[model samples]
Target: MRDNQITKEFFDWIRQGNSGCIFAKLFVLRGGDTPWEASVIRAETFDAPTVEAIGETLKLASKRSEAIQLILPNIKTPEQIARMISCLCKNPNWYCTEIIPKPSEYTSSFLAGLRWKLPDAVNVNWVLGFADIETMPPTRRAPYTSLAIRLGQPGTAPSVAKDKPNEVRSRKKENGLVPVHLADMPTPFLKDDAIKKTWVLTEQTAGKMLNPTPEFRTNAHAKVTFALPMDLRDSLIGCFTPVAMDSKSEIGAEEY
Candidate 1:
């Protein structure tokens, strides 16, 4: 009964925008049937809100002697924090407010990366106030993260199309397969010569070319190619194909 009350309070605190870590520790020390299942808590939600939820969940699980290591800084962004809160909100059907802060150097690309995850149209409220900014805890995280190196030898190259990935049938899901080269919106104001030079050097270094033609660099960057199913490759490239530009100020930024 006491554990149930704690669980309810912990969730309440999160909805009220309280940081989850403080409560997380308390729950961890409780050591009983964790309010949450480890399988439900992703390795990714280790920061403020989610971390708190995780801590509570872990505490319960520890009682049963079935807990794992707590991964830190798992909270990546405010949206992720908000999403978790939204997910666990008592009003389970509440729609997320779409919030888009203008892109700036100070804003983490992490939030911008969440654009696709948001509901189609979101309401953006100014979440920061002058006093709030002064009282906010300092984040010790590095802006640039070093990607972990994958262990073990690379897999042997596949031999046939039967081994290929399934074909994408919808434009909506096709964005996931967008080719990496065309993933970023191409810069137009930049010189073509400079773009070509960089592309040539990169291709040569990566051994992407077998019997390269003079126009290969331009074509390679402009279109997509791969060893996968041709239909999948086409679907991927089509996602990034530039629509006609209507005005000088209308460059569509590719959502990474």
Candidate 2:
């Protein structure tokens, strides 16, 4: 009876936009069952909205015993970013976002070296061996992050997640259970490079991001990614508009 009430109230709180870290700590500390089992139970029972609201909490529970996800920004080409931005324009939420690092040697010939530089501060492959970010307090996590480390070492790769948002969205019984992927988007802006040129965060800023900073970097041979702390996600999204002619606007600047 007590557990049932606790679970119900936790989901309610999350639906109201309260952070899930408090309940997550309790779940991690006292629950008799494994976190993944709990997550599956919730996934099976809750409606879509409830699941989405408490997604991070469920993710936190599922990852309590293991590593949480990590972010590797700036890994995509102009065309890839444009495709993603197009998808995001229509459906702002993606169920799972993958970070598959490609070597710089694979880059285009003309702008290969000048376009991007891989992180120099950390061993970008440590994640392949260790697997996961330090499970921080759950807020809204970025879908299901699958960090792909391409080394051929056995047991060194993260498995692709089975239960992603696309599957869940298609499974509502009303819609036919056909998955919708990024590639399915019909009108991706392939020519857009403006956003790429203006991206600001670098390895220096991104390293200070997570709760407990990681010891090593991902072994990316090219420009992997750049990101900010998750708390500012909403504010950041609000600023994702077209850059004006000057492109010199700073935070709180009148010109912006």
- On TM-score, the leading prediction is 1
Predicted structure 2, TM vs. truth: 0.17
How large is the C-alpha RMSD of every model relative to the true structure? Answer: 22.7, 21.1
Residues 1-256, candidate 1: write the lDDT tens digits. Answer: 2434434443344333232222223224443532322222334533356535644543454354322322223334433343333332322111122222333312211120111111122211111100011111211111211011111111111101112222111112212221111112122322455444443443344233322432222212211111121222222232222222122221111110
The TM-score of predicted model 1 comes to 0.19
Error of 2 at 17 (Å): 41
Highest lDDT, which number? 1
Mind giving the per-residue lDDT tens digits that candidate 2 earns over 48-162? 4643443354234333332222222322233332223223233222211222223522211111100100122111121211112222112322222212121111110001122
Candidate 1, superposed: residue stretches over 4 Å from native: 1-183, 206-256
Worst 10 residues of 2 by lDDT: 109-118
Q: Model 2 lDDT vs. the true structure?
A: 0.24
